[model samples]
Target: MHRLFLCEKPSQAKDIAKVLGANRRGDGCWLGSDVTVTWCIGHLLETAPPDAYDPRYKRWVLADLPIVPEHWKMRVKAKTASQFKAVKRLLGEARELVIATDADREGEMIARELVEHCRYRGPIQRLWLSALDDTSIRKALAALKPGAETFSLYHSALGRSRADWLIGMNMSRLFTLLGRQSGYQGVLPVGRVQTPTLRLVVDRDRSIADFVPVAYWAIEVALLADGSSFNAQWRVPEDACDEQGRCLNPALAQQAAAAIGNAASARVVKLRTERMGEAPPLPFDLGTLQEVCSKKLGLGAQETLDIAQALYETHKLITYPRSDCGYLPLSQHGEAPAILQALGRGDPGLAELLPHLDAQRRSRAWNDGKVSAHHGIIPTAAALSLDRLVGKQRAVYALIRARYLAQFLPNHEYDRSQADFTCAGQALRAVGKVIVESGWRRALPEALTPGKGRETQPAQPLPALREGQDCAVAGVTLKDLWTQPPKPFTEGDLIKAMKNVAKLVDDPRLKQKLKDTTGIGTEATRAGIIQGLLDRGYLRKQGKALAATPAAFSLIDAVPRAIADPGTTAIWEQALDMVQSGEMSLEEFVGKQSAWMSKQVQRCVSLRISISAPASPAAAAPWKKKRKTAPRKASASKGSAAGKRAAKPTSRT
Candidate 1:
């Protein structure tokens, strides 16, 4: 063959091969005159385990604490070994090769590792593709990059893999052995990313356990003016209030409630009104999409990712779904009219919105400077019909489309008014909000819009009144309540926490490094990382909430703080970015990781480890096999007065 195309998966290969006119199918490949196309099933090979280096490393022992490999090795994954052989055969037959994998670091590693392993010496080129649609593919084919340009991405990916192996192989063995010595039979798996994520949950659970409820009081007064009524809250004096401005003295609140109840009217002391405008939110990156899906659709992180991937790959309904950046490239703006026109044609439901959309309008989301490896997830002109999509797929597609449509609409405008009143020698405040224009909010689904949930009160509009106007007192209600503990992490909340973990760090430098790197895991890998923790029994689910198991708590307490610190992981990521930019070599980066791994092993070897064991081996295993039926939604039980009052009536008013 004169040319060969190497793709990441069979579906991707099929799509590209059709465009290349490689119609005939060969064994694990497609055949064309003087050209061929072949694919790998994800990664054809994985990093060799420790046992592959030496037979002696099979048994877990403290003496072999740090197992550093002088020469790294790659072993063909047994499951896909046959496919690997076919690719190797195709590589040897081709005169020239093209890499057409996913456009990211991990994808680069998947293809480059094979090229090096197969010893293919030929003219090489790279295919930078974002979408699998015909137009996108053909455009990319016309402008293939030289192999040397993306060589750094392969090195960066290699550095990440080697660092992960260094930590996963050495530290996991070190901890498992220590836990065994302390009479814990369960295996303890530690990772550079997963461990830090587990730490977040463990810390949150502990905070909830250690929290003490403090009693506080609040009074709500209803006032009437010209037959219209509004609610006002009692303002506590500075001396008798807490840091949050909650009233601390029960006697003072009771006295104020009674006085307000007996009073005839309240004089408005001060009034102010201001116009506010909120710009449309940026489009969904992977992390933000997963968070919104979990909150609005009750879907898990992995579940949301699966749906998004299907939309991109199978349905051809959206652009690449694994992007971390939410901003669109300015160059892509020219295609908006075509895509918007396609949406209107495919779905008649969107016909009404078509006239309102101004394809020429550009929002802040269209910025070339902020575009990263890929742009935000958006709909493609490839979509021909929305009727083919069902259930969660349709719901997710609606969300993505709404965000795109929002960019063409004006800002959501409103008027906010605040009024201060004096009644029975006590200070009171009333706040009201009125919408001047629905604007971008018109594109949002009612369920996804603001004020849909019971937790968030609906906006109230107050009657027009002068500063010195006296409003008649309608009624007064005093409430006694207790502060609530922090809620457990949902998958969505955990995803958000992972993205913004720098806020929890103490050191300024480390914190900034984390913020710059966008926290512990990349957008592409975070869902898988979280799923691994769930599969390993490190985290448990209580309804929609997530809590760390006892084994998880034990592991967190036993490990070195640096191993569990998200900031430390962020520093490692910063170094990887340096590797990608050619500021550091792969050898130097792996060397530092090895040295650090050795120190961690040495420091923990002499220490005693204690772990909280579960009642049985089966109990400690992941909660996957026997699925727990979802609990019925209800209010707090009769015993928890504090829980029942978690939603304060005064806040609702």
Candidate 2:
């Protein structure tokens, strides 16, 4: 009997077919003597809608909820139903099956659900491979594990899916009902991940709204020699300033400024010079890529993610798209040379630096221990093919290519020098620096340009002199500056915040726990989670920044404080990690989540939402109850005004 292969999507199926020598492609499948290949469009089957259980669930009504099913039913999605039926028939005839979905929780769910829904009783094996290359696929096909071995992963995926449904469906309906009861027509949306993300926006807005700027003063001293001038900004001693830097009293800054102003000349007290080495940056993960793209190129999180996905899936120019770790495995060291060679061939600028590439001496960013699930984003052997992409895709691919080429170069080194002078017994200082080596920065030299208010001063190496070097006081200028409030969250800033949620917590142990965990969500899901908020109208993008909607902020306020805080999600992530590692039971982790979902559902039901009524005619109707009218009789007078009335609310449960 032939082995049947199930792939996640049609593109993957085609790729695998090419690699497996199943080149004879049929309508919905490819067949070879050794294997038969078929594909799924992400998910061919999903949990049935509430209306599927009973006709009464066709309309929205609070009385029909908490629509809990005894055993959740599954149905084929209409668009893909025919293809699914074909796969189901193939599965029935095959003696063995191979699950060849992507290597992740959701991917595993897709495969498992297909097997269950299709009642595939044949012996099954899993095709787990990271890359879609010929070698990777061959090796995976050679050592497929029994389907039973992945049961735990399936259970975890199931728990996640059920929990999301329980919370999202019930809470959304509850809020919608509450809104309608209050004369609002807008949909009140809610989700497990989206709500907490929305809270981040709302909290930041609150902080910005309540921010008050206070006046502060700083003193600067200028020293001159040979018509060259350097200035140093002043800072109050730690003991002189209050805890909040109110300066203990404003008089202190006034006195210090006056003392410096009264001096005729200052004596050179001390001078120090230091050399510093700046290491190359860690490799780019999805979050870091999204962040840098947003800051540098003004790309949104979703935009960056899509680009990365295309670079991985379409261009084959990067490794797996969704990765949290910014480090590569030690085993991946040997492959660097080939990747660099490929990059050099694609870009002439990079080809010039090929001589300096060091494959043997590994950077700290390439450690194996730091990597989990997937390694840092790196260029594959695929050359840059800009002709294959347009718009955002091209921009994102360019970023990944630039970052990957930067890793193999040398470190950026600079020398820092300080000059000191004293006037009227007061000490003054100035700092100057020069680049020692452009290093990796040579790849992206424009990044080193100083911003506004920053002046490039000559190195000014001091002539060998003792402490008594006489220096003339240059013309002094007082510069006034006001304190600024914190900047708003851009997509990049938000990704950084999510990855480093530990910094937001006060407790050291708790902070460490969050750090040890991956923080709120995996790199793969974070962008999608953020987009879900935008799509649901819980958050809005104003230019490049994210701000919470009123309904979003209100929902966050109404929910339990812990649920709204990232700290809580951080803690849950820590627990989830423990479960994955077998330190904690899956049952325990899921039990806690279920309880949390129930509580959130109750909270949503109890909370009040005040929203303006929707202007659309379809949204203005009141809740209605079904009548004992026959469909034949109702249709006979369909054109009549009475017959055109909307259907009554149905019982989903």
Candidate 3:
């Protein structure tokens, strides 16, 4: 009577196998006398194709669409049939089974689908593993949960999969057919998530294209105080300043600068110093890690995830890389000192931090309830040599490790000094920061750099100052400025927008729903969703920013407003959460989606579409080469109203 373990992938399978002492290799699994360990290469079975529902679906036509399967079927993935057979055999033999997949909704789907497909009726237990280190693995094994505990997660993931398939299959066919009627041959791929993401880019491009740059001016004053000189800016009074606080009248700015420059002395009106303390940043969640890597290391979103996966799966240096939470469980707090000691021993650069590592100080990151399925990504005790990682891998590891070390350090303390002065009856202000205690910043020297973009408050340390003290206004200059348009979406910026989608929404209920949900996609799938857009030509690289192509604009315009709204994902997620909580049934959710999809298809099928009409091109980078255009010709017959494309939808990237 053997107990069997089923894991999501081979790397994960091997990790669990080592803990179970199932070292001997069999057909497609590891075997020991008392137990067997096996894995599916991420779902050996997938939902059957539309053709499986009916043969007529093999051809793409409008009438044949709205293909809803009555009895959903899953077939073994052709490439990994052998592994499926091996797992099936193991399931048949075991008296009891353990599900050892990644501890998330998708992972639950991967394992549970197989169990139902294999017709297994054994007592099922769950091994929820967040980290692969020996200590974490053993701790999880000692307290295995019953399969019923996570069964709702499987339903949630299954609901998402089926919904995506319905939208992808039906909508792609319907739109592609519509485009063809207008003589456009390119396939118009639409997705529940990708469409909204596409809309985000499309909207941003429109905002940029329509932007009218407004010119303004400001006055700069250089002052000398107590043997130290610093520059400050003249503050425009209420009557002189524009809505954005820019001096709209250039002459007024010039007059102010001239008056201030002519003044020989100035008097300090007020001085205030406030002490501020900042805790270390929370550790890396997959989204935050992807954002930082995209900005600092110049890595793509998928590239960052790939590097992180390698660190987790191949090197066993860090915990699971796909976690969404940035908080760690309080239970893991005791393990910090050992990890810190090992880190110092691994790199001489970290040796200086060894003396300051205070394990007793608990930051806001250590909360038991805040953590879900998995905690934040962190270094595992198995990590020894940083030398094993190179390039992006090494860079990401360092970032993850740095956040862990910072939690033990004291709060970063600083003195913020603001000096207000009067020069020739003009108000001028200057602000400076003085480090009171380096604290966590000692581990991160780069944090001290001024003008790091996000922190627009320039750190100009000032010398000792006194209220009502006299100072000389050495010089004054007038500077011209223009209100800049929004920049294109960088992957980092996109990730942030995705996480904070709640801000974009207006409907209070939907906004609240989005707050409860992660952005448009899950952390595990966001990178893939982005890569898929690039692959399909819906989104193209205009240098570093992702811009929706003309094709993308047309597809988004062609779709119903309900489908393109970012809030759609929130509503869907709300229902899925209901399924997870048993407030809604999976069958009920899918049925509702089918009804909604059917309404959308019927409402849209009769509409005429003409893609030959031009679309406003996304704003171009300065370095982009100008494209050569063909002589203007008459558009397709029964085509768009004019050669000029419609004004794009309003955008904010």
Candidate 4:
């Protein structure tokens, strides 16, 4: 073939091939007139294991703790070796090549690694696509960017990969050896990102375990105004309340409750009413989608990602599923009319919503400056009947669709009223809310609506009353409650925590760095990281709550503080960003990382670790065991310390 299009996966290759009219299938590729499309099943090659450099290094020893490679090697993954051979052959024949991969650093690495491995030096270009629909494919094809434009992304990815390998290979061996010295038989796998992520859960579990609930009291008074009933809460005096305004003194609460009950009426001392307007929420970024799905549908983070991936790759219903940006590109707003029309035709349930939608009306979600490589996950013009989707998939699709529809609706408006009352020398406060306009809220599906817990109480339209008006005191309730401990991280909550880790850091400079980069792992890899922890027995799920296992606590305590500190990892991430921006060379970044790794190994050589034995031999250790001839499947794949596919290196942070 004179022209070649290389893709990240078989599904992606097929989509591009269909658009290019490359129907005739060749070995491991599709072919059309002078054009061929081929794919890699994730990375066809992985970073060579430490043993690949020197056989002696295969044996874990402290003396060989930090094995920094002078020359990194890439080996074809055994499972996909055949595909690699096919791609290599195609590269040899093609005159010009197009890199058609997912539009991200990981995707860039997947295609670039193969080009370097196969030694293809040809005129090259990049097909940056956010969606696989025919129109998207054509648009990208017409505007192919020169390969040099994205060459820096490959270097950035390589830096992240080598850094992960440096840490994973050295620290895992060092810790596993230390664990053995302490009579702990299981492997202690430490990651650049997973280690810190595990630390987050471990820290949360500790806080929950160490929490001490304090008793508190609250009083609610029911009041009647012109035969309408509403509730007002007792406002405790500053001296009798805590910082959160909760009454800590039981005697004070009882006295207030009795006074309110005895008083026949409460005089309104102050009344204030204001209208509030809330703009529609931005569309789903992968992290936000995962968070909402975990909270609403009780799905795991990885599960949500899988569903979204299917929607994008299989159903072709949404744009890129792994986007970090939640804002739509201003250019995309012009396509809203077509997408809205498609939605109305595809789902009969949306027929009622169609009338309310104003396609020309743009919301704050459309901002070119805020959009990144990929825009928000939203429905494409290729919408189909919703009946074809079931359960979680349908639910998630509805959420994406609802958010898009909301952008064309007016703001949700409401009137909030606060009334301060005096009853028997005690202060009382009543808050009331009345919906002035349902607006964007009307477009949300029932599943997306606020739950009863979030509602707290039904909206009560306050009766019209002057500041000095008196309302009858109907009844009083005294509540004896205890301050609750922190709730365990659900998969969704953990995702949010991972993205917003800057808030957890104490150092302002480091916190700002974390914010500059994505918090812990990339949006594409966080779910995988969390899943990896659960798979390794470090995190156990109790219903929807994620609790750290005993082994997790031991590992966190045993590791160097910097290894488990999210801020340190986030700083590494900032360095990687510098590499991407061409501020730092890859060689310099790797050298610094190697020196750092050596120091970490040297410092922990003599320390002993205390960890509980694994519940089972299989789950105990993925590293070496004294008596066993073979170790169980590795806690993680080789070089994937982040608990994700190494081909697409997750930011070690």
Candidate 5:
């Protein structure tokens, strides 16, 4: 009798099969002499929908507002049921079973669900590994743990799932009913993560809408000399006044600009030079990778994530893709040399820096304690063969590979100089930077264009000078500028905001509490969370920026404050982490979450929602009647084909 092994996805199953000598492949399972490997397309089992428990729920009704179940039931998804059955048969016949899903909460839940649904009573073991590399897989197989060892993780996953269901089901129904009553046609979708994310978009929109710009002025000075001319900016002293002493007078700026214009030439008053060094950026986590890709390449959060996933699961050039921690384990120290060597093979620039790759220099960011289930995303020893990757995967892989190679290079060193000149009565200053050492920036494509403003500028170098030194001014001209409002959030900026939510809040204690909590949703879930808001029509994309819909704003206004606040999610995350760390009981956490959901549901039901009716008579009908109109078929034309391709796959745990 063979030991049956379960993996998360086919790519992972293939890697595990190759390592376990399970070469005889079937539809979804691989047969070996001692072990048979099988895989699931994410989730094979899921919480049963309301309709599954009661026929009345087939048609959503306001009367059936809160469909709370005594015990949530699990159902095998119809699409993957046949594959699940085959796995169940194998498990029943096998002498032992091994779980080899991804090393995370969802992975643990997948194994638990398979065991629960199949009723497999055989001895069970778990194959826990961070990456799909042969060495990692082999080691994991050698020391597989008893399935019970991860019961806590399974419990936590179950708690999260149940909590989401309770809140999602109750609130979704409550809002949908209320929305219809108020004459809204669109589905008022809600979720644990989706609602909070929508609230963020709504809050941001509110801020931008209510923003009041104030008039401010700055004085500009121009100097003329050789072909090179430079400009200087200064603010009028607060004590300075117009003809009248009142500081509020706008004419004071004109007076200052005129006074500076009258000066013949500026004399050197002070000069300062400073040397600075900038370290290479830390390794990419999923959120960081998404942010950078979105900002630099105009990829959506989901698009970037999908590309990163392919790079990890298909290309095998990166570690686990959906990682939150930006740190690697100490054991991975020896692997850096091989990674650098592989990177140098594909990128010509990296070849020059191979000798400088520090095998002994351990980064504090690469600490094992900082890493939880998965390490930071880094390029594997796999050579970059662009031919193997199609569209977005190629782009994402290039980013990961480039970032990994960059870390192995030296720091950027530069000299910055600032000179203050007194021209007649006005003071003017000139700033310049000179690169002393290109360092890691040498690998950057835009490093040479210092002060260009298109890309990040290299540090400036200052010349040595004294107040008495007479340096010829190149030239100068007045430059006009306008004060602009805060820019809207791109997908990248939004991801960064979500990751650093603590910084956005003004309260120090709350900020610290948020820090103590999980920074944001797990990497595996963040993109989906963003997508959910979009699907719900709570958030819309406007030229790569997220803008809140009117309905979303109103919903946030109607909802309880706790539901809209990131701090609440932060607190729950903290408690969940405590459960995971064995610091708090799973029962305690679940009990509290269940109670909170109950309270939130009650609050949602009691809250008054006043939706403005559409101007058209047909559209202005009560929500109940409007909801009967079939939901618009999600058009394949609206989104990329990749999104459509993903829809066919079975949901994963």
Candidate 6:
């Protein structure tokens, strides 16, 4: 039987073809002696527009507010129609087919949707590949999975796509028509994921704008012991502070400062030192990687994902770049030494650390149970020079390599000393840390302190002293400061916020569900969703931070509170996860979403609502100036990271 393979993209197809000896190039495909491999650019078929159902949908009208399709249809893009035809032709000729796409929900949809569209009736198998390396491909080929095992993934992805269409199409049209009546001619695009995300930024801006600064005071004392001085601060009693640990009573601070200033000498009431060990951090999940890159490298979310994808597909330097898990499988441990050796050969400077590289060390990162779908992104044994990589690619690769190197090193050990002093009838405390062993911290030069803020205080070793020892009080100072407002969302902060949205919620059940699920969006689509917001002018970039536009604020206020609440995202994801596990049928999930969309439209059709931009401090939210006074409208139906979809690279075809 002629077995045919379908891939997600041309580069991925080329990689698999090289291993299968598929040298001859056919139209939009590669042909070997017995096997053929064809690819979809990203998605070959998308959900049909409203016009496909009825001719009058081409014109925007209020009566066509809730456009729910009775029978969903898939439409081929005019740009990629030829390639779709080629894949359809290949499907017609094959006796059986193999789905060799990205090992994720969107990847499954890209191949399965085409199969359904072409009406293919043949036996099918799955090539679930996490990494495109030759060894990984060959191993997967030897153990092909029955297609039924992964059929649920297609249902889950299809559910997300259909739900997006229902919300995006119906809510967008409803709101745009409403806005036009108010004399604003802008299309307001909304999604299950985007509305809540916009609300996050808008809410933050409101808090910043309304915040009033509070004054606080702190007293710092310099203590002399054995001719060496260490810094300590006066401890505020519980009676003098508020619930947030802020010293609300400035008189208490003044009294403590006066007491210290009058003291001739201080007695050390207690001194204790204890040893502590810190384990190495796990490798980067895509969210963490995007976060760190946005903070350190000054790259946008899309830019970081694009660079990582290039490293995985174009250079073959790293394993799959779209992994959500920050852990490795136990089976992958054996390949570490070879990868490290390759790294050493590629960069001669790494020779110093090669002797310490241990593949046998089982850190917290290597666990079979923790890994799902794909393991963490790490370097491959491709043996390529570092000079070939671009600046940002090299920076990201170096970070991934550093995390791997840390596993082999010893635990970062330190000695922490806490000292208590009583001076002029006031209590004071100070801490000093000494490094016992550099350990894994030496692997990354940036990791030198036991805690992140510990470096601000110098790590001088404490002098040998017993309890009740006397020491001179060198100095005392009282500093006054104002409470700062919350900073606006940076791209990194936004990604981290999106990934950990459970913290924002107050409900116990939804919080637990969000924890089980990966926040608002999957690793593959978070970038695309954020990019879409910026491209659609709902969110604008101001230096290094993000601010919502006036239209965004207006939409958030005009829509029903259910659509803008972060808790709604968790509920939707719970439904999607259930569908993926076969606990709920795809039709049931889509039916529920469509019903929700239709209800929202009907409720808001004749409702009168005011649209006002959320006010914010100019320094924090720069987009507040872009706020336009939109006219009041009589009635209109209103509208996560977005659902899992591939973040197309710069070169998709």
- TM-score top scorer: 4
Compared with the true structure, the alpha-carbon lDDT of candidate 1 equals 0.85
- Per-residue accuracy of model 6 over 1-653 as CA lDDT, tens digit each: 29899999999999999999999998989999889999999898989999999999999998988998989999998889999999999999999999999988889999999999999999999998867778878988998999999999999999999998998888877876776677655465668888888888777666656556677777789888899888887777787776655576777888888989999888989999999888887777888888888877788888889998988898888888898888999888888888878888888878877777676788999999999778888888885788887688888888877877888888889999988999998888778888898778777756322255544356767777679998889999886755666676777788888878898888888787777776776788888888877755567776777777666667788888888887787678778889999999999999999999999999888755444332222312343454454423222111101100111112211
RMSD for all candidates, in order, please. Answer: 4.0, 10.6, 6.1, 6.6, 7.9, 7.8
> lDDT tens digits, residues 443-491, model 3?
6658421123533456889889899998888887787776676676767
Task: Please say which candidate is ahead in TM-score: 4 or 5.
Answer: 4
Better of 1 and 3 by TM-score: 1
Q: How far is candidate 4 from the true structure (C-alpha RMSD, Å)?
A: 6.6
Question: What clash count goes with each model?
Answer: 0, 5, 2, 0, 19, 1
TM-scores of all predicted structures = 0.93, 0.84, 0.92, 0.94, 0.86, 0.91
Q: Model 4 misses residue 161 by how many Å?
A: 0.8
Local accuracy of candidate 1 as per-residue lDDT tens digits, 395-430: 999999899889888888999888999999999999
TM-score of 6: 0.91
- In model 4, the worst 10-residue window by lDDT is 637-646
In model 2, which range of ten residues has the least summed lDDT? 633-642
Q: How big is the RMSD of model 6?
A: 7.8
Q: Candidates' lDDT values, in order?
A: 0.85, 0.69, 0.81, 0.87, 0.69, 0.80
- Candidate 5 lDDT tens digits, 48-148: 99998899898877667666676678998899988888777877888888888888888999988888888878887888776666765676778888888
Best model number under lDDT? 4
Off by over 4 Å in 1: 450-457, 614-653
lDDT of 3 at 276: 84
C-alpha displacement of 290 in model 6, angstroms? 0.7
How accurate locally is residue 248 in candidate 6, as Cα lDDT from 0 to 100? 61
At residue 230, candidate 2 shows an lDDT of: 60
Worst 10 residues of 5 by lDDT: 635-644
lDDT by residue for model 2 (1-653), tens: 38888998888888788878888876578888778899999889887877888888778887666766557788889999888987888888789998888776677888888888878888888887666655556766788878877656665566566656666677677777887777776565566656666677676766666555555555677765655666664556678755654343456666776777776656666777678776777778889888888887788888888888777776676777777778888877777787777777776656567787776657777787787766777777667645666777766776666666567777778777776776655556667776888776665547522233433343444433347766666545444434455566788888888888888777787877777766766687788888766655555566787765555555676556766678777776666556555676766766677677666666566556566332222223323343443322111111111111221222211
